[model samples]
Target: MMNCQFVFLLLVIYMLYLFVGAAIFSVLEQPYEEQLREKVLNMWDDFLEIHPCLSEEKLEDFLRTALLVKSFGVSVLRNISGFEVKWDFVSSLFFAGTTLTTIGYGHPFPISLSGKVFCVFYCLIGIPFTLSLLSIVAQKLTIFLRDRPLHYFHHRWNTSNNKLEWIHAIVVISILCLFSFFIPAIFFNFLEENWGYADALYFCFISLSTVGLGDYVPGERSGQRLPALYKLLVVGYLLLGLVCVFLMVEIFKNLLKHNQILSLFLLGYEAGRQDEEIDHVSTNDSEVPFAPRNDETTRRRVTHSASPNEKSYGSISPSRAPAIIT
Candidate 1:
């Protein structure tokens, strides 16, 4: 019952967060949306006046068709933006990547029946593959990046696990913010036309989070130089960025598992026990290539177990082993 309550509490918080986001976006964007609507209406009226032969209903139908094409990422405007092909090799690769990552940016979607059917099957297979890939990459990265290095320092410097965890959290957050967001945002701010630093930062955060709002996709403007290269780079960024996110999440989860008191408070007793069980499997999983317990760690544990401090400082309790969610 306590676990259920905790879960429900988390759900409520999540719903509240979503509602807050909806309210904020509505407040920010609705006025601009209304203004754009009125502007479009005025433009239509003026166009009808200038082109006296065109009927309002006919123009409306034409406008709808044009919008439909635009939604599929094809521009039909009168040579305002040059003909940018949506189905090129690079574009298809980017689309495929986004699909596998489950980003699902709203534009350039399939309108045809066959293409849509293919997309359904593609996602069915691809999303799992992408997830597995992310898991594998994260595991490999954590061994080199988090597990071994932290263990080495813990033994060599005689650092406590709690200190190491705090350091890991702060360092990882800073590094990810720098590489995954800040640096890329700087590049995007310069590269994207009419985009300010905030817009670029928003795009980076949204893309990395897999929100893919489609409000401000990079390299979508008119006559952009090296468009294919830019798109391919974006795909690469998504792949690496996702891996970084996965690694960061795994680290924080480990932090939580190691801090049993915090876990009990946050997850409740039943859920924390379940999490502990999962952590045992995670320890087993590490036996393959990048297990948290490297040979050095094992030797250190062996040496430390003979000491008087084994229970107090050397070995972590079975209940508090670092966990992965698999």
Candidate 2:
């Protein structure tokens, strides 16, 4: 129950963060969008005034086609006026977040040399920071789950630790899959004008895994209402999904730590056993065979025989001599 409450609190905090980001980006981008629209309209009016021979409808069609081309970062007719600003604050912020997370959704990118240089430095710092943060959070969340719910189940059922860990992992992973992937996919399906549930699910999976193929980015379609809000929510979903992925990884790590079946696949244990056997054989080979100690009579006979006053030691062996001290 405590764990459930903690989860709910985290959800609330995440929702609040999404809302705040949406509000800020909306405020920053809306004015720029409006200004750009006004500039385009003014250019069209000037064009119509200068080319009075052309009908307004034809002029509008030509300008619309030209604007479409401009959207793709190409300008076939350069003299025609259109607004082209890609690095507004909100887009830049979103790009930075995606880059740091390694999501790299290619909706927007740096085109200038200085901007590219800045991006290189930014990622060098950001990637490690993001990875460290993910690891720390993953560890804490795994410990919380293990100690609270997993412990409860283990003591109540008198189960083995390995079994309990597996049970805990399955339950937690199912919940994460439901919330982070399935539920968000449904939400994105509804919010994105062109995306179906399958596409949304694929996008969520790709973004969370940091594959970010860039084919199905959300909130960038034409005629999207409250696009900033949608983009912000997508960012929040990506972040939360990544956290759950990290949590799953940590849980699986704990499970593998005690899994006998998986341990059999490791060669380290075999290597250790071979080392022990080799040490045992080397120890046996190094041992010196014991010999019986010579008695005092044997020593005296050897010394007297070697003095040369008597027969040679070999010829006056103990077998040929009378029993002296004995």
Candidate 3:
């Protein structure tokens, strides 16, 4: 019952956050967007005025067609040499990888009927595969980045579990953030001439978070060298970054467990059985049947457990073998 109430509160908070973000973005961006819209309208009127013999309907159709072409990732920026080839083999390969990864910069999407249909089917199958891949990697990295170091520190330093967990969280978050976000942003800053460090950092955050706002995509600049290679690198970075994010999320959940209020988000539930797979080392106390340390509730819970022959998730078989369980 308490968990349900907590979940409800979190939902309310989330909705509030969304509305606040919407209001803030509107305030920040709306005026500029309106100004741009007016400027474009004026440009259209001026162009029509300069070419009075041109039919207004024809001009409107042409404008719409140009916009549609750009929307479909076709470069409508024509010069004497013709528009850039955006759908060539390398570009298409990059587009396919981005689509599969769900980074989807929104610059190069399928325009054709068959291509769009294929895209829908491709994503239907591929997104799950991508997520599964990330999960698998996160599990492995959890062992390397989280488990081994934490185990060593706790055992060697004789540190308390609470302090060790906090240290673990801080260390893991720092190292992963450096590699996944900060380092990538540095590279992006150097590679993308128009991007400032802040812009590059924003791009890294947006891409790795899979928000893909498309406002700050790299390798899209005209005269960009080795655009295909750059896109492939971005896709690779996204996969590694996602794995780090997954590991960070586990740390986030672990830290949340320490906080009585925030712990409700987990609702004392995990996706799968926690007891069966892991053994020997300290497990989440949340998995324990009830509080066992000296207290009225603990005493009652112990009596209840003994009466019911309750099984604890901890490794040891239960008959009040707390040390063995840990």
Task: Identify the candidate with maximal TM-score.
Answer: 1
- Residue 65 Cα positional deviation in candidate 2, in Å, after optimal superposition: 14
Q: TM-score per candidate, in order?
A: 0.77, 0.58, 0.75
- Reference-based lDDT, residue 146, model 3: 75
Candidate 3 Cα outliers beyond 4 Å, as residue runs: 1-4, 49-55, 80-83, 266-326
> How many clashes show up in model 2?
0
On TM-score, who's better, 2 or 3?
3
Off by over 4 Å in 1: 78-83, 258-262, 269-326
Lowest lDDT 10-residue stretch of candidate 2: 288-297
Name the candidate, 1 or 2, with the larger lDDT value.
1
In model 2, where do residues sit more than 4 Å from their true spots?
A: 1-85, 264-326
Query: Which digits, one per residue and each the tens of the lDDT, describe model 2 over residues 217-296?
Result: 67555556666666676777777789899998887766766866655444335545777789897676445232123433
Instruction: Return the clash pairs for model 3, or none.
Output: none
lDDT of 3 by residue, 4-77 (tens): 56567778989999999999999999999999999999998999899999999998899899998878766677
* Candidate 1, 83-144: lDDT as tens digits: 27888788888889988898878778887899999999989999999989998999899988
